[model samples]
Target: MKFERLPFIMKNLIRYQATMKENDWNKGFDLLRSIEFQEGVYKTGPMFFSMEPAENEPRYRNFEFFMPVNFQVEGE
Candidate 1:
């Protein structure tokens, strides 16, 4: 993640968790709805893994600016 986006991500995470703690189900859902978790693609062979924003969700499309390049090392 980029340094600039880190704060926003962290703040959202904390707020989301806090809402959950306060039994604010609606707010928590809203927070989750606004946040997007995207999967990162590593260009090493055919390996794949789950990403945060989910494939179809677009709330995080703006945050796509923070997508990291897939760097792979030899032998896992």
Candidate 2:
């Protein structure tokens, strides 16, 4: 694939992960679940998320998100 052809792709899914915790384990779990992943339904626009598996730690919970973004070219 040619590098210049990269821009032709309009959007792509970007994977994201975060291990968050306030103080306790329950709080962290609640916080992670409380996130409103609207999937671009309201005003945020369309979003594509990845459902990859993740390992949980002792205290904090792991969160994964795949957001849609426009293609970008380096040093364009």
The best candidate in terms of lDDT: 2
Across 1-76, the per-residue lDDT of candidate 1 in tens digits comes to 6555344221112112221222223453443334332222322222121224434544432111121224422210
CA error at residue 58 for candidate 2, angstroms: 5.7
TM-score of 1: 0.21
The Cα local distance difference test for each model comes to 0.27, 0.39
> What pairs collide in candidate 2?
40-45
Q: After superposition, how far is residue 45 of candidate 2 from its true place, in Å?
A: 4.5
Q: lDDT tens digits, residues 3-43, model 2? A: 55455232443445566542433443333233333232111
- The C-alpha stretches of model 2 lying farther than 4 A from their native spots are 1-11, 22-59, 72-76
Location of the lowest summed lDDT over 10 successive residues in candidate 2 = 35-44
